[model samples]
Target chain A: MSEFSVELRDVVKKFPTPEGGEVFAVNHVTMQIKNGEFFSMLGPSGCGKTTSLRTIAGFEWPTSGEIYIEGEPMGHRPPYLRPVNTVFQSYALFPHMSVAENVAFGLEMEKTPKQEIKRRVGEALEMVKLTGMERRNPTQLSGGQRQRVALARSLVKRPKVLLLDEPLGALDLKLRKEMQLELKALQQEVGITFVYVTHDQEEALTMSDRIAVMDGGVVLQVGKPVEIYERPNCRFVADFIGETNFLDGEVRAIDGDRVTVYIPRLKDELVGTKASPVRIGEQVVVSLRPEKTRIIENKAKMGNCFSGKVLNIAYIGSDTRVFVDLGGVSLKVWEQNKISTLDPEAYYERGEQVWVVVMPENALVLHLG
Target chain B: MNPHRRSPLVVVSTALVYFFLYMPIVVLFLFAFNSSKTNILFEGFITQVGPTEIVSGNVIQSPCGPFHWFCELAKNVEVRNATRNTLTIALISTLTSTIIGTFAAIALQRYKFKLRTFSEVSLYIPIVIPEIVMGIGILVLFSQLFTLLNSALSLIGDSQLTLGLTTVIVSHIAFSVPFVALVVRARLHGFDQSIEEAAMDLGANELVTFWRVTLPTIMPGVLSGALLAFTLSLDDFVITFFTTGPGASTLPIYVYGLLRRIVTPQVNALSAVWILIIFVAVFLTQRLQSRQAY
Candidate 1:
């Protein structure tokens, strides 16, 4: 068996527009998903995340290049012949069938023995914590319960690679969060490679072992969740993944992986780490996370310190988000609310003069585009 | 001025509309048991007398008590043949049109081709065209085609081509297909396509997915369409008149013939029975649909 559970090598999918020209839904892209890994394709709507997942599932054949499942070429293979099952975003449960029948559908299609199908379906429903819902129709179940049924239906097939297209997207926030943890745990227990697609970054971050961030039919970066959030390789990735304050500047100096960017508005040089190569005098943007910067009383030991006035303060229970103005540039700093206090004066006040400190490692230097 | 409180004019108008719609049917049903043979007057109820008797200088007797006209209708050889023909035509046309129309609806709704829009728009043509015009058109087309086939094969006597049950069934199917397609297409409009994808993802091939998932999901629509087709074929008059030949008369045509001859309560009895059958069929289908609606 191949080490990789699924691989997409230079896959491209084009769809014709109403104006008769074609648009690339999935541009030339490649990905290798290892066995038993929880890999996520994360992007906004129309960024080719779901399209990429569809290609791997054999619902769509690539316009060019190839897809391989377990080292076997899947050229023009129909979805039924492919050893992959998808949990649709809509939780496409069969309304006509009972829960057990829905979960047993795959086994029945394989013409498995009736006794075996019953046992497997029971076990699958048990895994989803819906063991007693065998007689309930899909329409009678709640949205979250239906989502679990969809999961159980696909998992009962025991596919080599399971494709999930925003399986928890229709659920409430609390349910979605719970399902995310449950799905991660289930993947670990089953030892099956999971290719999850979602536009929700936090869901992807909390569940995926590795995430491929995509935008405009292109994958911007692929890495662990921490690496994607902390050291995004481009402006889109840095802006899309989390809350980041961007400062447009020109590269001033390069020292190994560290680079100095001169911001015209601040009239100061901000030193940060660069993931991609940049030369001196090249235009770049520095991405500084809100939580990475701190409001310090003194700027003595700070590497990149700026004297600014607090423009606004939003107290969101756990953290106080402070928007600061340093000269003509605006920056955001998040301060943890460690002390439990009812005093209104404990947080930063508007128009209060504060010094913001951004550590060199916390700042990310990325290409301007 | 409250929205829920209807005005006097609205209530009267609604009552008038229903009265106008159902008064004729109620009259026809009541007349089914009229003791007068001429059906010009209601002498008395058929069940008032157990045996033939003269009362107040009027001879009163019911051939079959309260079911006099119904028994007459059942015993008439021509009406029996007409009923058989109607049912055979209705059943055959309904089944054929349902299968063909479902295929058309699926193709139009699910697939994209060069002529897809044209094909979809054409389905509405048969529905919008007048029934009389469709009847005439089918009649002319069949006559011309039969002429050509007869000359080509040189058929004679029993081998000769002519309009009969086959022609009536074909014409019914032609008109019924569009209604079935439209109804089924309406159902398909709200369908989520990913359900089929889920079935395929579960290792079901296209045929299996359709049988196990797609057909059952859209079955209510198909059944309702088939019911509409069956009713259309059963009661059709204009097309059946133009297409029916010797020994192929249906119930409606037979009733029209009876109206020209001696008017009898048997006609009322047939119509009353027809209405009852339709009501029972509709009620049973509604019950079945509600039971499946979980």
Candidate 2:
């Protein structure tokens, strides 16, 4: 448990093309997954997230470099020999086998005694909350039931690492949301290293202890979910992990820890933290969260404030999204809902002028380019 | 679709075609127990009701003896020999073709490498070429081999591939392999490769996965193809005609000889029996294969 569950060093995988030449699926990816940590690889489709997972699962071998599990070098071993089990996205449950049979397959292969196999199978079913449904065929179950069976099948093995490749991607939105929390709880309860992969950002953000945001065969950032969301290092990370408005401006003044920047259209001096050290007049991108911006009816205590036209106002359930057109740039502001809107609080309609303000500390200057 | 509308077009058309196709066979089947000494049964110009127990639309009973028909059929030695020969050849050829054809299908379908497509195309070549051409090819090859070796040994006749059990079996296998390969390969193309991979991932080796997972999935296709190949081999005439010798006479050959002479009731009875067996075999196969695409 103290060792790294899985370690890949400079791993490279290439696939041959029909017309000729090789396409590098994973180009020199070096990642280390810690024991008992839930790590997720997130990216768009065909971006090599699946390829990387398959490579680690031993179904596909890395064209170059070494992979180790629990400090033991595992070199191109077949899937059966690897101390890992994968719950595939499609659930991949045996259609002909009943639930108990599918869950007991690995134990049967290990030639466990029949009584022990039955007992363990029963326990595994209970762990997945599928105890009473053991005799049902996989075809008779719903999508979520099949997924639970798949999880049971993999979990009962007690592998060093459980590789789950988009296991909840097929379910409906409601089911997917429910399963996200279930999976997180399950991982915590079992205390096993879960290598999960999904393209959904919210699912990864909510479920993973640490998230690896990947795109185009490269991992851009890896950190705790909150850290990655709050302190995104670059434009790609900022845009991928959460909603962020880019305030394109040049640094006017540079000093210790803080700098004053002039937004051209807003005509306001915006103060932001120096994430990357830059020259006094160098151009930098400020990633400002919409939720951080406030609507100032009169005047408010803030670092930077400016007047704008309230171009649009959308009423979400718990909050209202207001789009303020400050000159040429339209900034977004999220206002919390209140029941005491009897006076309507001098509601601003389209083409109405208003003031949008933000605190310097909350406005993040994250990237240079 | 409507009760008021009166159109028996489909039923009338089908009945006409059915009678046209099966009238002779049905007549022959009926006469097998018709108590007639000869094959021809309705041998009267007009028996104009001196023995009248007939209504306008009633069936007229034929005046024939029952003992002669049954006893004569039972006592026919040629009929007995031909029936035995037919059954033995059909069963043996079917069994041989199935074994060889299944092996051929597996080899040709599973692998891809140098000259594999060419080899597959060559297998199909035997199917497309005229049967007489194939028969002639077999005859020439056997004759040349026998002449070369027999002359050297001062022998008169008899070679390994000459018209006997071995030659018939070999010829059937050659003709049937391609059909089996065609059917099995088509089924294999749609087979899910992941199931095999999953079996392997669960600690089964390649051989174990193939035998347990892959083979069972494609078994129905192989069996269906084997049934087709068996029927083809049993009914084969042209190729068997050239390859078979006197001792290796098959059912078709025996029937052909019987037909060349006088048309005996024994021949009709034998034809009815063979037809019944074919119908039953086809019916059972269809029952097993109901609605399955393969």
Candidate 3:
């Protein structure tokens, strides 16, 4: 078998608009998911994440390209012929069937022995923590239980690759968080390649081993969660993945890996690392995370320190988010509340003059799409 | 006045509406047991038989006690034949129309083709047009087609084709198909297409997925549609009147003919039996549907 469990080679999917114009739902996208890897495609709605997952699952055929599952080329193969199953966002359980029956349906399709089907279905339900819900209908279960049933139904098939289209999207916040961790654990236990699609960046980051951030039918970056968050290659990825402050600038000087950008608003130069090569004099945006920037009293020791007035301070439990205005550009700085104190004077006050310092490595110079 | 309590006027109006709707049926059922042959007067219940009496120059007897008219209705060969014809036509038309209409609904709802819009819009035509017009149209079409076929067949031999139970059943199916299709289509509207995808993803092919997932999911709608078709066939009068041939008279046509000749308590007995059958059928269906609800 190939090292990659699933691969899409320049897959393009086009759908016709009601007005007779064609729109590319997935545009020239290529991705390789490694074996037993938890891979997630993260994007906003209509960003082709779900479309890419569907193509990999063989629910849809690419207009021009090919998909390979476990080294086998899938060309116009229907979903039933592919050894992949999907956990739909709606959980798409067979409402008429009981939980055990729903999980056994795949085995029955494979013509497995009845005893084996029953044992496998029981094990699958137990894996999803729904062992006792065997005889209950899908409509009788809660949303999260129904989601688990959907997971068991798909996982029971022992597919080479499992595609999840926002399986936890319908759950409440706490349940979604719990399921995210549970799904990551389940993927590890089953040793099946998981191709998850979600619009929620936090969920994707928490569950996926590697994430592909996409926008407008294109993948902007694919990397580990830390790499994606720390060194985003484009403005969309930086903005989409997490909260980041964008500083508009033009490239001034280029080093081997470091680049200097001149911000017209601040009338100062900011140095940051560049992942993709940037030409001198090219316009780019520097993405700086709020948590990476520090609010300090001493500015003499800092290299990229700017004295600014605090515009707003929001005291969230673990961190204090302070918005600092450096001339016309407003930057957010997150200060960790390490010391437990309820005193009002312990926190930075609004309109107070403070120095915001960002390390050179923390600022990411991204190409303006 | 209490906000939850209904006003006196509301209660009276509701009672009046129900009374208006069921009064005639109730009277007909009550008259089924009446001993009077004329049925214009409320004769006392004469369960005990005395000596044979002559009323209005005709001999009247209550051989079957209070169920005299029902027994007479059961004995009438013409009514029995009509009842058999009605049931056969209804059952056949219901089954055929249900299968055809379900296919039509699925095709219209799930597939896109060149004439999809036209087919969908035309499904409502049969339902919207007057039944009498449909009856007349079917009659004319059948007459013309049978004439053409008979003349062609005469060239070879003396084989012939004429309207009978076949024609009645065909007409019933024609009108019933649209209602069934519409009802089934309404059920299909709320169905999630992703369930079918899920089934296929689980290694079932198109046929298996349809049989296992799609059919079971939409079965309630199909059953309700079938029930509607069956009742429509059973209750149809205008279309049956025009489409039927000799010796193929249904219950409603037979009742109409009986009314034309003379009104008897046997008609009331037949109607009372019909009301009971319909009520039982509706009750059973309702119970089945509730039990099937998840």
Candidate 4:
């Protein structure tokens, strides 16, 4: 009924605290997830990301405001009446049922014909790469296999949207990563809108078409992974998305799209592009990603460059993380190790003098509040 | 410590504990076949060799009639009546309590309402409060209610109400519900609420979700609770004694009456059979529960 697959309009969900005070779990959260887009709500625990997803799944009814799915208002409708299915974080595969039976449950609930249910269940199991395991009970399956059964169970319904609440969270690290790609590929193949909820930033960034970074029952930023990571709108979004070196400063001057930030720690005026309109007297934080800043043996000819002593050098397989102390403040910089040699001479030594060079276009001017 | 080698102290203590637990039941089973009417001691190791009876000592007059005792018990009218009454009350009460208590447990576990905590705590009252107090309370309640009913009936005709098997069953159900509820509640504690949600989200209604998902998940606990209720009802004497009328005596009450009259080996035979039934039921319940735990 709506252009967007799902929309929440100023939804606020209040939960009673143990002390009897009411706290908003989802406070005035407004967002529209497009049709067939992989939209993720990413945040730390207790930040209302799961609540927002649950609201969309119709598991939670907002205390105030309204929710719409496919242009239709969901007014006190139970989850059974809603046209969406969820793969729960715990897998939630029916332990008593076989994989095929679990997958066919939604179809059976809809009163689908016996032939169609069987055909569709078979197809669904095939889609999840679990064709031969149909007769096996969920309890006999491994964590990843159970997760796939849950996926197949929900996906067989062919609902308007599929909700995944940290479906890969229980798996081991390698399996989680593998499933992350498989889930993205499966979503694209099915062409159904997905509302994925997770606190893992890398997971959100790796698969989502767009991400909504939530904190304190609020949606702080909603944008593509690149836009959210590179040009975060506020301090929390910038820091939470990835490893960012925050330079607290005052806005000294604004020239066109370029703004000069006066940092007392570096005793230097760093120039970067502003994400929003800023006044000269406003306090700003320059969000510089660790990977964006390069450690140079010599001073660069262009951009913001500062000389500092290397505080720590850590070799983390793929890259070398160098922390440099620039007078009063230290900046973390990640440099990819391009060479394959293990020679000691190739690595940067601690306490070595180096220049921290940040590209002006790479630095983002974020609002203090 | 090596896995195979247990310390002597541990082995001795374990053996002592087993002896303390099972010695009485073993003695009861042994004396069920006693040749004499009294069951205090064995009658000089009397032995039966096929048709001809062989005796080790001349002090005994008859052989230990193991099969004869069971045969006499089966023929005894009171024992048969008690057995029938015990089984009937146990089955009816177990069914009633399991159904009512499962619903109560689900409502308490899944929903929040006014007086919810009070209701939850009230369930424990029947379980933890001494059975003697419960028996007296039920007896007083029934007598007062019976008097009130009879007075109302006096308008039409004069009739007196008397406690019977129905009263016994009702009282058994009253105590059985709490034990059932406690067990089902423990099962529900580990139940993943999301599985129910997933069922509903998959378009199954609440009733269907309960039958398809919730019931099957907690079936082991419900069965075990029912078995426990059945055994409790079968072995119950306190409440049954207080509530039962003259002709409605259950097996335990009948056994108590027999013991007061005389310590016949027939009573031991009945007890041995009762103990066997209870052991089988309890063993089956434990097996069912342990299977579900995995």
The model with the greatest DockQ is 3
Off by over 4 Å in 3: A343-345, B49-60, B155-158
TM-score of 3: 0.97
Cα lDDT computed for each candidate against the true fold: 0.91, 0.77, 0.90, 0.88
Residue B160 in model 4: lDDT: 75
Which portions of model 2 miss their true places by more than 4 Å? A249-270, A273-284, A298-307, A326-332, A338-348, A366-369, B1-28, B31-163, B278-294
- CAPRI classification of candidate 3: high
Order by DockQ, highest first: 3, 1, 4, 2
Q: Give the lDDT of residue B40 in candidate 3.
A: 77
Evaluate candidate 1 and give its CAPRI docking class based on DockQ.
high
Comparing 2 with 3 on DockQ, the higher-scoring candidate is 3
Q: After superposition, how far is residue B210 of candidate 4 from its true place, in Å?
A: 1.2
Q: DockQ for each candidate? A: 0.85, 0.32, 0.88, 0.76
Indicate the residue-level lDDT of A32 in model 3. 91
| Clashing residue pairs for model 1 | none
Model 1 TM-score relative to the real fold: 0.96
- For model 3, what TM-score does chain A reach? 0.98
DockQ-derived CAPRI band for the predicted complex in model 4: medium
